[model samples]
Target: MPTLEDEIRRLMADETARLHAAPDLAERVMRSSRSKRRRVRVAALATSVAVIAAAPIGYLTVGSVAMTGQEPTISVVPEPPPIDDTPPVPTEPPNLGDLGDGREFGHVRVGYLPERLQWSQRSVDNGDRYSITYNYKGDDKGSYRVQIHMYEEEAVQEVDDQIQAYRGEEDGEGVTVGARSGYLVVQNVGEDGMKGTPTLFLRMGDRQWAEIMFSPVYAEEFSSAEAVDAELKRIGEGLTSTM
Candidate 1:
C-alpha cells in the first residue's frame, strides 16, 4: 500500500489551501484606504476655506483695538446757526455833547416849568449849540422869554429869524414832543421885531434838535392866544428826552 512520504505531502497541501484568502480581500482594503484619504483631504480643504473667510473680521475686531490700546475713532457731526426772524428797528441816540445844569440838556430835560420862571441866562454856541434863557422872576417889564435851543442839528429846514413867521405854515401842529416829532410854532416878533415867539419843535436823535421858545412880549406871560396855546402845549408835553 502508500508509504510515509506520500502521506506527509498530502497533509501539507491541505493546510496551504485552508489558509488562502479570497482574491478581492486585498482590493477591498485598498479601496477603503483611498476613500478615507479622500475624506480627510476634503475636510482639511473646508477647514482652510473657513479660516480664510473669517480672517478679515477677526483682524478688524481684535487686531485693530488690541494692538494699540486706542481703537479707530470715527466721529463727525456739526452744523447749526442761522436764525434772525426780523423785527427790530429803532435806534439813534448818540451825540452826547452839552451836559446841563439848571434844566438839563445832554439829550433833553426841563420836565415842566413855571414858577414865575427864572433860570436866567446861558448861551454856548460852538460846542454843538445851546441857548437856555428863561426870565420873568421879579420882572421889570420884559414880561417873558423862556427860550431853549439845544441843537446838534437836524430839524431846521431854514426858517430861522424867529421861525420866519412860521414859514408858509404846514410845520405847525403834530406834536408828541420830548422824544420826537413835535411842532407848534407861532412867531410874530412884533414889539418892533422879536415879540411874539411860541416855538416848541422837537426830535432828539438822528443828530438831535429841540427849541422850546415862548415870549409873550418881553414877559407878559399868558393872557390869550388860547392861553398862549395852552402854555405852549403844557411846555411841549413836559419835555424830557435824554434820548
Candidate 2:
C-alpha cells in the first residue's frame, strides 16, 4: 500500500499530462479549419472579381455590336415650283389682210428704200392714171431700174402684155398674178441686171388697174414665184372697184 502524499503526487502528474494533450489536439483542429475557410474565401473572391470584370466587358461589346449594325438615316429636300409672269401676245388670222377691212382693193408692202419716188398723174381713155418712178441704187445701176404705173383700162389684157414685156417674159406665161380677174406682170428692167414682178389689180368693169413694182428683183429678192402667186391671190380676194 502507497503512502497518501505519494498517491496525491501521482494523480497530479496524470492530470497535467491530459491537459497538455487536450491543448495540442485543439490547436491542430483549429489550424485545419482555418486553412479550409481561407481556401473557400479565396475561391469566392476570385469568382466575384471575374464576374464583375466580364459583365462590363460583355455589356460594352454588345452595345458596340448593336450600334455598328445600324444604318444612318438621310433627309430629302424638294424643289420649288416655277413662276410665269409674262403676258400673252395677240395674233391675227392668216386670210385677212393687215388692214382687216373687207372693202379695200389690195395692199402694198413697201420695204426700206434708199430714196422715195415722186408720184405723177395722167389721163388714160378719159380716166385718171398714176405713174411712180424711182432710182434703184445697186451695183448694176444702169441695167436695173424700176417703174410703176396705174391706169383705167377697158380691158386688162393690154396692160398684162405691157407688164410681160417689162418682166422680159411673154405675157400669160411664167406666173399669173392676182386672184379672180387680176393681172400677173413681171419686169426685168433694172440697170443692175435685176428682175422683179409688179402685180396689177383690176376692177370688175374692166376700167381700173393698180400696179406695184419692186426693185432689186421680185423673183430673186423681194418675192419668189410661189410668194408672188400667194400675195396676188390674197390681194384679189380683197379687190374692190375704185372707178
Candidate 3:
C-alpha cells in the first residue's frame, strides 16, 4: 500500500503537466489575430500611398486641358507692290532753209517735186563748206519731206552710217555730180504704203559735203520718179561750183 503523502504528491504532478501542455491557448490566438489586423492596416496604408502618388499626375493632365479650353495660337504676315514702263516723243520737225543758210556758206536751193510740194533750203556754219536742203511734202497724209546735208567725206560717212543703222539697206547709188562725189540712199517710207524716198549725201572734200533728201508720203501722188529725179538733177545743177 502507498503512503498518503506519496499519493498526494503524484496527483499534484499530473495536474501541473496538464496545465503546462495547454498553457495560454486563448492569449496565443488573440495575439495571432492582432498581428493579422496590423498586417491588413499596413497593406491598406500602402494602397492609399499609391493612390496619392497617381492622383497628382491625373489632376495635372485634366487641369492642362481644362485651362486651355481648345488649342494654341499661330500668326501670319502680308506682301508688297509692283513697277512702270513707256517711251518719249519729238517736239518739232527741223527747218530746212534755216539749217542750210546757218550751216552752209548760204549756198543753198529749195525746190518742189512736180511743182506741187513746198520746199526750203538752209545752211549751218560748221566751220566748213556745207549745205542742208529741206523738202516739205506739206503737212498731210499723202505728203512727206526730207532734209539733206552736204559736208566733208568723214562727216558724210558718219551720217550715212547713222542712216544705214536706223533704216537697213534698201537701195542706193554712187555719183560724181558737179565737183562732189557721194551716194544717194533711197528707201520706201510709210506705214500704209511704199513711198519711195531718197536721201543724197555728197562728200566734196575732206571737210566739205552736200546732202539731198526726198521723202514722199504717198509716192504715187507724184507724177513720176523721173520728175523727182529731174528735181534732184536740178538741185545738183544748182550746187555752188566755187566751194
Off by over 4 Å in 3: 1-146, 152-154, 160-170, 188-192, 218-221, 241-243
Which regions of candidate 1 deviate over 4 angstroms? 1-83, 89-92, 95-101, 104-113, 116-149, 152-165, 169-184, 187-197, 200-210, 213-221, 226-243
Alpha-carbon local distance difference test for all models: 0.58, 0.44, 0.51
Task: Give the per-residue lDDT of model 1 (tens digit) for 1-243.
Answer: 676545544554565467675544444555786688666666655555555566543222222222222333322233356689998999634433444445775557877776667665444444566556667666653334677777665334432433444545553565674345666666565667655666766655566666777765633546666676667667767766686
Model 2, residue 72: C-alpha shift (Å): 99
Candidate 1: Cα lDDT at 22: 55
Among all candidates shown, the one with the greatest TM-score: 3
- Which 10 successive residues of model 1 have the least lDDT summed? 59-68
Q: For every candidate structure, what is the RMSD over all alpha carbons to the true structure, in angstroms?
A: 23.2, 30.5, 25.2
Residue 243 of model 3: what lDDT? Answer: 39
Arrange candidates by TM-score, descending: 3, 2, 1
Rank ordering of all candidates by lDDT, starting from the highest:
1, 3, 2
Question: In every candidate, how many clashes are there?
Answer: 9, 14, 24
lDDT for 77 in candidate 2 is 35
Cα lDDT tens digits for candidate 2, 1-243: 997645655665576587755534444555786688666666655554555466522221111112222322322234456688888889532322232221221222223222332222211122345433344334342332333345555545566567556556445343333334455555445677555455544434455565544444533543466665565455444445555
Off by over 4 Å in 2: 1-127, 131-149, 153-179, 190-192, 201-203, 217-223
